[model samples]
Target chain A: MAGHFKQKSKAKQDIPTASLPDIIFMLLIFFMVTTVLRETTVQVRTILPKAEALTKIDQKRLVTYLWIGPKKLPDNAIGETGVQIDDALVEDLSSVRSIMYRKLVEQPKLIVSLRVDGTSEMGILMDVQQELREAGTLRVNFSTKRDVVL
Target chain B: MPVIKKKERVEPFIPTASMADIAFLLLIFFLVTTTIDVDTGIGMVLPPKLEEDVIPPPIKERNVLKILVNEQGQVLLEDLPSAVGLVRDQVKKHVLNNGVDPRYAEATDKALVSIKTARETPYDAYIQVLDEVWMAYFEMWDSEARQLGYANYRDYVAVVGQDNPIREKIKAAISIAEPDAA
Candidate 1:
């Protein structure tokens, strides 16, 4: 019995860790491949509304976001509603047509995603739509969350 | 004279002990920064700018279901006061009427749901109304698909491409009328 106990105790106790780096490298490569670096920092406050009927935009490359919401002012004060395209807040509504037109020239199949805040009025959204219309970029999406039903 | 001893052999190999730590550091950085949230939304196609010479097609009033939403988020269905929840049933009835109800649409193809909102209408209110309209169409499609031996409309769509005849049979002809300039 003592000889059997001593033989059992001689078995390898530590787990083999030689492949640990390889495993970690595999995980690291996966993350690197799937990672989509966030390019633009959204300046406006866009709390999207919830809805039931929704569709997924699979092609992220084709989408250009147009944010319409109250401006995030200094000291957390909400300023007047504004339209933001990419990084810059649009100062002139008419200029939206030119910027979108230029983007359309680059990528003809561009889909303009309107990320409007729930509390915002429809006036600004309609104006953006008109500009989108003038730009000949007909495809648009209204970004909303999925409404969960109990 | 001193005898020269054999030089001690040293195994030339890269140290792999810290390799895992380095990879883990990078992995953690990416894991912390990466956000895989998929975007979900309602897709729409905006009408192109109309030319001055182009005359818009005129449709009969009975074929169109007008849903007007005011600034107060109050819904007016066909000029009648209606709630947001009632929109789905009403839209379904209007689309599937098929000449049975003179008050509703004449036929499925002739049916057009026009949603006109006020300039000051809340975005959520408008989305709610649009959502109801889309839900009604989706339910109709679901039933149609079930009749055709499919689980749901999405399944049917997956089997048959977007250009299927059923899509043409019960088309979602929703029109968003531009709000008058504020």
Candidate 2:
């Protein structure tokens, strides 16, 4: 009985944690290598409507821009009825469609941000939406000003 | 003496726990790295431009449908006060009778239609008209081939009418606008 107690061999128990950290590091590297980056390339020209609740977007290109102003004329913004692309006049909505398609094709994931005048007719805005869908550039955001909170 | 004393039982090593940890780590890694998209409500198609025989037609008022909506929300089909209920009927009639006028045919060749809207008219009216036009096109396409009136599938007016009458209607409706309305 005395020999049995004395013969007990307490083997060294130091399970290596180095292997775990090595694995965690490798996983971190793999994720960093495989991560995809998103770009912001606007498909249309839009002047976001003035809003009482607007916040500044951190970047461009992630957003598409559209400006709706006077249609058919030399471009009088005070009273306009059509869309603008990068500030140039688009006489008709079809122009908007084709241009958007081209942009969407180039940048597979681009969000369109609309800066619309509050007074713009809903019909025209809907028309813009209809065109966007046909072109497959669906991402949309509205530009607004931050309201003064009382 | 023969062989040896009974061999002690041998235990095989198992790595179940390690494999599970590795898998879980990989799963979390992928979930955090994917990109997502935002969507817009409407779609658009841009027209293709060609330089060849692109000619502007000598468009006159008779060939044009001339839809005008004044600031007061009165809808005008060809300069006449048109009600929302009357839009489909009037447009349908005009489209069906399109072949009656040669100039209406000619004006459409240039792809012009004058939708003159006042500064204050609601934009919804225009969208409604556009929606109707698309619906009418679908109807014309479906009815022309006798897909709806099949006996098992049979037809007498097979290919009698020309395709795209709506395009003609749009063209004719566009001519002769009040140039300054824009």
Candidate 3:
């Protein structure tokens, strides 16, 4: 019995690391498949408002983002409200129609997600909406965080 | 040395000991950078641009439930001074009235909840009001789903899809009235 116990312990002492590579490779493949690299660095301060009526946009490819918020200044101070589409801040509001129209031409089923700051006034958002209407890309999403229940 | 040393045989084997180490390195890199946060928000389809000469189909006064948000974030439900919290119940009552009250909608399909906001109104306030209206519609759908022996509207939608008649029955007809040009 003592000899048998000794043999059992010896066999179990090495945790059998031969399959470690396979396991690790499996995990690596999973991470690689699921990885979505951050594309653009946002320049505005967009603190999205919290709400309950939230829907998940499963098809990430069909959605385009429109960031609206106060511009981040050099001295950590926020400047006037600005609208950003992908990389560049839209200098002229009228240009929004052309840019969105080009995007609509590319992806007909484009859903424009408005990531607006909570404190932003309705004026800028309305202007953006007008441009979107002109561009004929009418599907809009008001991006908001899930409101935590107490 | 006597008979050519019998031509010494050496077995060849590939080294796999470092394979796990390399995989672990890559795994750690991805683990550090992967962000699985999903994008969640309220989805709305904006009305298409109407032609200059085309006049929109006129909706009856009773069919529309107008909720206006002023610059002060104060809500005006049906042109009456009201709090934001009351919009949900008022919307539900208006939609489900079914011709019972002359001031409310004639039917569920005819009911249109229009949210009009002033240019100076905070975005959050508009969102709050919109959220309430959406919640009211969701609650109605939930009850409708329960009556159909389903768990909730989502479950029912999963089974029947978006184009089903039930969804068309209690369709959420919300209109975002454009603010006056500044």
Q: What digit string (tens of lDDT, one per residue) describes model 1 on residues B26-75?
A: 99999988778878999999988989799889988989999999999999
Q: Candidates' lDDT values, in order?
A: 0.92, 0.52, 0.92
Q: What interface Cα RMSD is found for model 3?
A: 1.1
- Per-model TM-score, in order, reads 0.91, 0.39, 0.91
Q: Name every residue pair that clashes in candidate 3.
A: none
Question: lDDT per residue, candidate 3, B1-182, as tens digits?
Answer: 84555545445578989989999999999998887888999999998887989988988999999999999999999889999889999999999999999999999999999999998899999999999999999899899999999999899989998787677888899999965522
Residue B42 CA error for candidate 1 (Å)? Answer: 0.5
Question: Which residue pairs collide in model 1, if any?
Answer: none
DockQ of each: 0.77, 0.07, 0.75
- Greater TM-score among 1 and 2 belongs to 1
**TM-score of A-chain in each prediction?**
0.90, 0.57, 0.90
Error of 1 at B18 (Å): 3.0
Residue A107 of model 2: what lDDT?
84
